[model samples]
Target: MSTTTALPHWDMTVVYPGLDSSEFAQGLSQVLQHIDELASFFAEKQVQALPAAPVLDDAFVRDFEQVVARYNAMSDEVRTISVYISSFVNTNSQDDLAQAKYSELQRGLTLLAQQATRFTAWIGSLDVEALIERSQVARDHAFPLRKAYKQARHLMSPVEEELASELNVSSGSAWTKLHGNISSQLNVPLKIDGETKSYPMSAIRNMAFSEERDLRRLAYEAELAAWKSNAVPLAAALNSIKNEVNVISRRRQWESPLEASLFDSSIDRETLDAMLSAARASFPDWRRYLRTKARLLGLEKLAWYDLFAPVARESKVWEFAEASNFIIEQFGSYSQRLSDYAARAFRERWIDAEPRPGKRDGAYCASLRADESRILANFKPAFAGMSTLAHELGHGYHNLNMLKRTALQRRHPMTLAETASIFCETIIRHAALGQVEPSEQIAILEASLQGSCQVVVDITSRFLFEQNVFEKRQRRELSVDELNELMLDSQRQTYGAGLDEAMLHPYMWAVKGHYYNTGRSYYNYPYMFGLLFGLGLYARYQQQPEEFKQSYDDLLSSTGMASAAELAQRFGIDIRSESFWRSSLDITRQDIDLFEQLAAQR
Candidate 1:
């Protein structure tokens, strides 16, 4: 195990010396002033949604461009300051100053949300084609413009929209914070290795990857109990958040929270339906892989924790440096640009790879300023840790290509945002295969399959669970047992006979922070979108590396400017076509076939 003290803490001096520094204070003031400027501009132009045409003249061009310029700069400024302060808060949840700063910034974020909604509603009132024909700026941003215009049909009254935005700060946003603060600080009481230790939830969760069945079982039991004891608050938080989404979605005339999520993710109903249909078709294959694993372990079915248990002859040790080197090298085989960007990230101390008291669990890559990014992870000397590191660095690589785009252009939706990361992960996994021992091969194959199963199968469960929860939330609040039952039913539907029904993780609703999010509901499916979309791209890269290489970076850079289908179309992918998603699922099926082949050797 890697000690927290031994891991690197990220350097944010690239953005500011410190929060108390004059530079930091100045940046904060500038964002405030910019907000004021924007508000005045809105007021001066009487920028409410007009029932008339888009004033498609030189003055319209001037106002739209001016708003774009100010809004973009302000967005970046706010993001820089937000990410900087959050670096400290996320790393040390106990930091009072960081917590205070974050709370202060929430006001700014809320105001920004209000302004954006107002702007979108105003744009929604316009005829998108006339707006584009009237201005060069509009033509350049036709995608978001068109989207805003379409979304206008769903807008509430301006007063209602503003009220909803403000209430979200205390209502939805506060509930999310409560969940984060509690979950991050939660610990499970477990007696392990002859000592009774109160382990943090993340540490306990990590035990799921242990080779020892007893350890995994103990940890699983402890985790469930911990979440159970904490269920009241967690359940309340979820109910509050989901109900808020329901109310807001209803007010906006969305059929469901899933409908709102689709609009937010820049995906269409057809694409999602096709993806889910293909995913359903592949469930049997995933069950075969799971049953094989269970058979290898001499069990009829896998317990929830056994899903990630190592079935290889031996687990490989991976120190942080070794893992970094392997990922960089593997990435280099695919793209020198990706490899070099990764090297810079590590060299510049751009990652905080440590799990410590007060530090949050899991890993994420957040953009700082310009194209620079900071990554956070809980380092472990195992394959899972290394892969997670590579996954996050892939996000950094995405941000690297996002360099020099305006704020709006760089703002990729969740569906497209996972593209570069998944692509990079596939590169690493592919490189590992065909170049290792049978034991090592089994290990790699099982790990890869584990992820695919989650993205395709487990994610389906989450989607169903959340969708049902959202629907039920519209009627009334649910008890913890209800949430658990919903979760188990979802798991049973998707995982089928692969996992022991009795051992299914009913508390998964409490475990995943995704479900607690008020804004980004149905966050689970985007991983599926990314995985399938990325796999399809990887297939192309193999067939035409040179041709694919040149256009790949451009595709990532323009994620914000195009719809998901439009981006896929540039590369001859029809996202709405069921066969397209099936092709991606076929790649996973091949992995299952290889796993079956290798299991026979054992």
Candidate 2:
């Protein structure tokens, strides 16, 4: 529909001219100095050990609050430094200086974290509710304080905690970084139009969404071969990271790694179980959709590679400028606040949309500051790419909504992180469907359904794979072969008869970066959570358009301050109930029904 010769790149000058800039150096120095100041203040108070006779007088509470306030201030400054360095490295992972600076900042942050352990441990020993009631500052930070106290049992001694932090720099973190380096540099061999060429794994993977079936199959085969070549080292990274998590979780007295993840997610086992059960129940509808898709493509069964193949012959190619304007307009129709934020993001060069060498494969939106958010994506002139832009911009909009809150209050759990992003994506997608010609409806519907299936079916498979990996890692280290087997088994169970058994992806674990994070386990289900939750909210909006906007805004604003369950409760949503999840899945089912009807017409 629209075309452009060049896409946009982020203006990092707003952050710093370079890592060598005076501002960058000064920021790092200030962060270190603040950490030293915090360490000195706590050490002077002799707060490193548990007090034999604890007292909570007015003077003590005032001084404690002052220290906490100072800590929060310091934390904000350090976060600014961390966010800039992370953004730089994410887009330039191969840069040695950026990588070195990231490591340095990580170590500095770990040291600062070690210094805070004493204060946290002291807080843990105190009566949090009484403290909150007694002091205004404590009341203001009740959520974080109470959470820290609840987590006190899992905290090791200050020395042990520091050692763990230091070890992670070279252990878990290093392994994950190595995996990133390896994956980013991979070149998959694909034969396209009688020419056998070696392309970046990312480019080949993008071909999965191509309109050409033969090309998709070729890309899939090459991608699998590439992963198989590096499976051993990738497996090692996975094993090491999971083992670290398993040991730390056990030492922290968690029942299992999953329990620790739940604690971090601020959700309980009951809620996760309910949501997963609901997901399983919706498998039949998803399978039916898959069958319909296969028939439309003239295949008896769909292969893993065919999952994203375009169902329509004519695909729309949207230019970068056109897509951005459309998204802004669509967002404006819903809320001027959201549209304004998206407009600012594009106008201020907050997004990097160009594809280049040594860049990361996936897309993400980084909240660099309270008021500033940066998005990184590899843009193409396809509907899928436009959807991606909307998704990342959705994250930007979420960050925009949170600009007024404190740093601590702006940090939402992963479970609710995708709410705004998915919501925004859905907005643009449905709007496109409504405006497109009847002949173009199937492609639009297929694209939407592909995303839905990913969040539901594929995410379920990842959850199952990670669960099995954790369970098995507790007994012993799993070999590369075992990991492949486990992944294949998980896929079989999740995809069922919908996907061709002979063509299912066995190297999925090697490709997904989710499993490599040592601090977070079971990082898959949140997609399912975010999608279903957003869909339910979207459905609610349809019922009462006038009232839902403010409610949605309020919900996004409260994400950082409340738990998932608490936030859902604000909208009268019982996230712990199967019926609530079913309501969301029912919307997806309706889309599938429409897709089937359209395919039949074709």
Candidate 3:
């Protein structure tokens, strides 16, 4: 628990001096004006209500290019400030100004949503291939255009879509806000030094990684109690968000909410099915790893609190500076560009790594302008800490590679989004395992296995839980108790004999922010997708390091332009094949075998 040193706060000043600054105000004003003008542009160009097969003359082609180009340009302007406000809101949950500004910004997004619906609806009737040939902008945006057209099948009328968009600000978005505010501000009671003290949820969560078993147990109990206390609103938020998704999903003529998510993910149902099948088959292996970990901890079965309890033979505390250097050096082994990008991110203070009360939990990198990204992390001093840095910097590097593309072109789906990050994480893990001493080897290998299990096993539980919630929510609102039961059931199904069933986490539905997001469903599976997909790609990179670099960069850059299957094809990997996924799983299976051998030695 050597987390005394202060982690660096990112350089937000570079984005904008402050919320009240002239530039910030101008950004807000500019977006408002652009949306208004965009609406006018839609109206003037007859962008709404196009004929089933509109005459694609030269004039129409020229006008359509402007429409798509303008929309993309406007999106960049909108995202620049949108991420700025979010960075503040996410970092400081109590930042009233940032919250207010974000709400205000959503209004403009609502109007933009209306315009986008109209545009999407209009594109539905067009000959996408014909238009792609005629307009350069159309060619550049062919993937998004085709996607919008395909999505048009599920959309309501422009009027209905607009109404839904407007209501989202108060319904989905507001409920999500409530969950975040409550979760971040939540202070759970924990006993320390004979005095009961209240710690913010983030601090309590970080303690999960702490080596102290008693402390971890206490934090787990306190966290569950806190969530139970707040479960009413959190459950309401979950219900409302899910119900909204169900309503809209049905309205859009989607067969299921999962189908809509599959669409949004730019991945097909077959691909997901393949991945999950492989994942389910590997569950026993993961359970074996868990059992071995339990044995190492001198227990028969692990409690939920012990899942992330660091298992290291020779433990090392990775301070912020040390972790940063380690990440940089490992990244350099892959590519100097990646190494340099990570170095610059650290040098320029592009990360806010401090774990504090107001700051939210987890780590994510938000692409601000062009290639610049701001990463938020609650950095704990361990192998996981350094790996977290590498993971986020991988995201930053992904953004850097896509710099030549427009904002719309860079808008990749969640399934593709995690690949680069996990790829970087693998780099750090693999490099560290090879170089560390036998004692540290146990530490690094276990840490790596711990992370893989999370993505594979824990994520499977979350996906199952979300599925049941969605299925039941379609009938009626679920009670808090019902949600807990569903969560426990999913955990039981996934973890099986690996964990003490009585000690499983039931409030995981409330703990994860993934479930609270109304815009996306099935956020859990994407991590699994990323982990396996990334492992597969990394394997290729190792065999043909020289040839793989450019091809790999191409795949990352083209993520937004193609489906997951299509991208996988470029690498000669069939995402829809269970064998492909099984191959990826086998990579982790080897590690699990190694871990069991090491555990036997211990």
- Top candidate on TM-score is 3
Every model's TM-score? 0.97, 0.96, 0.98
Sorted by TM-score, highest first, which candidate order results? Answer: 3, 1, 2
List clashing residue pairs in candidate 1: none
Residue range 1-602, candidate 1, lDDT tens digits: 44323678999987789877899878777777777777778778756778776556788778888887877888888888899999998888778888887888888788888888878888877777877887877787888788887888898999998998888888888888888888888877999889998888888998988878999999999999999999999999999999988888889999988888899899889999999999999999999999999988888899999998988744467778877899889889987888898888888999998787778888999998886899999887767677888889888888888887788778789999889998888888887776678879888888889988999999999999998998898889999999999999999999998999889998999999998888789989999999999999999898999999989999988998999999999899999999999999999999999999989988
Error of 1 at 273 (Å): 1.1
TM-score of 2: 0.96
Candidate 2, 62-141: lDDT as tens digits: 77777787777777778778878877677767888888888878868877777667767777888888888899888877
lDDT of each: 0.87, 0.85, 0.89
Worst 10 residues of 2 by lDDT: 45-54
Which runs in model 3 stand beyond 4 Å of their true positions? none
For model 2 the local lDDT of residue 287 reads 93
> How many backbone collisions does model 1 have?
0
Minimal lDDT window, size 10, model 1:
1-10
Q: How many residue pairs clash in each candidate?
A: 0, 0, 1
* Best-matching candidate per lDDT: 3
